[model samples]
Target: MIRSINVSSATLRHGIIHSPFRLVTKPSNGLRFCRVRPLSRPSRPSIILARLYSDEKSPKENIKPTELAKKVLQEAAKRENIYTIPNMLTFGRLLASPVIGYLVVTHQTSWALAVFGLSCVTDLLDGYIARKYNMQTVVGSVIDPMADKTLMMTLATCLAVSGDIPLYIATLILGRDFLLFLSALYYRYISLPPPKTFTRYWDFSLPSAEVRPTTISKYNTFLQMIYLGSSLVFPVLSQSITIETAQSIGMALKGLEYVVATTTILSGLSYVFSKDAVKILSKPNGKP
Candidate 1:
């Protein structure tokens, strides 16, 4: 009876342990089982990466127009053709003209005289530099002569107004200028052709055949400078030399004035008679 009881108990325990519900509910034989869906990683932000690359490359790709212009200007400045010593001297003389005029107008006679002397010195230096360095230019040729005439004319007018120089001297100088202007106009218009060849005596050995300063013209320039310098001294020395000395100096300047006037007239006539001058004058307005 006891053995039967024991066997029954054992069978009951085995049935409980091997039940299918228990097996399905719990893991068996130390193995884990899980049903899981595959994970989907977050999508990479490609748009943000593209924008970062574009931002990094933009400055290298974009160049401003002004920067390009500055580069071109720098290249132009590096060229060898433009800067010359003679031209620099001529520019200095030109700049001096206005300063001299201002000094004279302001009644700073000594300063004006000093400035005028500087202008004259620059004139000589320009010519010397041009010859020494072989740095002549067409622009210099025109500008140099024009600057000289302009300075002389300004000084003469100012001195006349200040009563430092006789009115006759100013008149003579202006008259000469006027006559040359008229001749130039006539040569351009009515003459149809101007004379080209200059007399040996009238030629100053300038490279240009059309315009050359004569020996007389050079002397005239020297005398004009002397006259102007003497006027500056006359005012200070008047007490010592008395009226006679002033009058004597005035007479001498007047004589020089006549010589210049005569030479100018004769030279103009000679230019008018030159064959090449005629040829140049004869060209029609557009026939160059």
Candidate 2:
């Protein structure tokens, strides 16, 4: 019977050329003959794999990967302008944080409360203006949360030092914020565009990454604000208000402190586990 045998691995010592496999096409007189041919595959560098694909003829024709990333980032930058009334108000609130802390530390309770109230008003005003006027920018996204955290840290530190808030709770709050700050720095360094330099890294106007605060994190910030604000305002109110009202309000705040502690732990953990907390802005392929 005429038949064909496949010889996948047959070492031929006499030949110098190496093929993947030898195929025996025919058998005759109890002997098999096969042909050996090298299979050639065009080698493509892995670095070339990062390609921006849009139109069928787009990336394959003219533009390179790094150039396309710059184009996309530039387009993003155009859409997000840093100058806006809301962003200005947020910057003002950030600046007021240290003043409030200083006032608290110096035992100027009335002055601290007044300035803190103004800062809170600006915080609310900035966010409302940003959403209503469509003045959202990448820098705003970063600095808004930064301002809030700065206020919280300043108040927590000042209150803890003055023996107003529990030292342990202050420690937890500062520790979590410090961890998040380090993480943000690391992400900014890695996600930054090419030719990353000292100047470019510090320039917040350059849009590179966006942080979408989680739902729990939002609640945590609100709770922290209430906790810190009450810590400042309650004593001043206690002197003027009735004894019964002071006792009741003090009880309510005592309970809130525990709630804030729990939420602080949860919000910090949420950042670690949540997938979309921080998003790196880039093309679908070849992340820049």
Candidate 3:
């Protein structure tokens, strides 16, 4: 005779199927089972579990392009423009150039001199900042000197036109710049190395055999700055000093101009006599 067997509900829920051919009964264990039913519908627990896992997996696939762009922009915004105190000062001088010109033209001598002096301070501070902070950039190298030239040229032109300086002085300074500019152009066109000015300062060492600035060129730039500063200051200072004293100052400024002109000519001659410069100049027209 066959006897009924008992099975736990947990086993049925877990989808463990048993064959109905035999049964063993033990009254001490409290387990029961009804007639086995074939599963007509899919297991609800398994379906729910699959849906939970699929939902968890979708977010990685759903990340859109817009989200990536936002992330990139956020990273970019965190980056900083390099800053140095000296460079900031130099930038201030650049901004002050027009103010100085306006004061000089309006006969505000004291104010113009003050502004010019501030610009000089900025120029000095900028170099210090660059060296101290190690925040130099290619843009700074070009822009710094360009700003200096602008201020110097503007002051020189104003002084020359106003009869404070001789026209020849202005012409000489500007002419040297022009010649150097043309040489730079020639070098660029021939694919030769660029001019070895301050921009190339990093490439050479002390006592190195590189084609570098002649001492005369350095002296020329120094005198140019001196004359520029003096010319800017004289008109303002003249208001306090007697005519003869002012004339003496003017004579001294003119002497500086002559020195600058002579040094400039000598520097240009040195570059012209350089073997590399001669080779570059000898290149055929239309040759790249």
Candidate 4:
């Protein structure tokens, strides 16, 4: 027969059977459990924090702080009226000039063609957009033409070094640019204050030269770009196509080159002997 007894504290006081607790306790299978205190509720601040953070978006992984900084800077630049779209395009071309030259020297004809093509497109686009929108800055007047000159000089030098084009042609092309650069410096030196060390090193400023491209010079530049582009592209195409086809294209480019050379020489001479050029170079004393 099974027996069950309800023992009070008085019965447990004798220590005949050990009780685990001095207060209320229970026993089962020779183990004792005392009454447990309940856990306290979370603090108000903790609850508020949990609720506040619960719906927040998880932080994006693999995002660089520098990248975020660059984006913020770009937005700030837009607001500050410095990096307008047309100026950005001109700056891009300036940056690309060296890469194009490198590609030409390394015999990466296809890539050179692609880069030169893009440069041409951006050149036209930047000028058109600037004029159409009336967003021409004083800085753009200096930088846009400088970018064009730099790209032309780079391409001419590379082609001359590679022996794909005659050395005299490159010399003629670059000599014109050098003369114009000197002319600009001469004008600015007379007109403006002496430059700081940094500005002097670059030889660039807002008021450098306001010389617009002569119509003949514009055609000359177009022809020069065409000649350079064709020189890079034809060699690559010849590798895939027949020699006869390549020869025909080569003859056409040669013909174009002659026209370009003639125009280039004429434009340079015209620029040097122009009334404005004479005035800038031979300024009268005490005229101010």
Q: Which is the better candidate, 2 or 4, if ranked by TM-score?
A: 2
Among all windows of 10 consecutive residues in model 3, the one with the lowest summed lDDT is 202-211
Model 3 Cα shift for residue 239 (angstroms): 3.6
lDDT of 3 by residue, 1-288 (tens): 335644432223223332212245444336643344333344544343333333333534543445544544533332334355655666777788788777777778778887887787777778777878787643355346556766766777777777777898887767766776566454434532334355432331111121244566656666788887777777678988999999898888777777877886887787777664333311233222
How does each model score on TM-score? 0.53, 0.71, 0.53, 0.64
Q: Please give the TM-score that candidate 1 achieves against the real structure.
A: 0.53
lDDT of 4 by residue, 159-273 (tens): 9999888888889889998888787666655644333244543443324335666778888888888888777777677889888888888889889888878998998887766
Clashing pairs in 2: none
**What are the clash counts of all predictions, listed in order?**
15, 0, 1, 0
**Model 3: residue 6 alpha-carbon error in angstroms:** 50
Total clashes in model 4, counting residue pairs 3 or more apart in sequence or in different chains? 0
CA lDDT scores, all candidates in order:
0.55, 0.78, 0.59, 0.69
lDDT of 2 at 229: 89
| Residue 251 CA displacement from its true place in model 2, Å | 1.8
Tell me which residue pairs clash in candidate 3.
Answer: 86-126
Model 2 lDDT per residue over 175-196, tens place: 9999999998987887777667
Cα lDDT for residue 265, model 1?
61
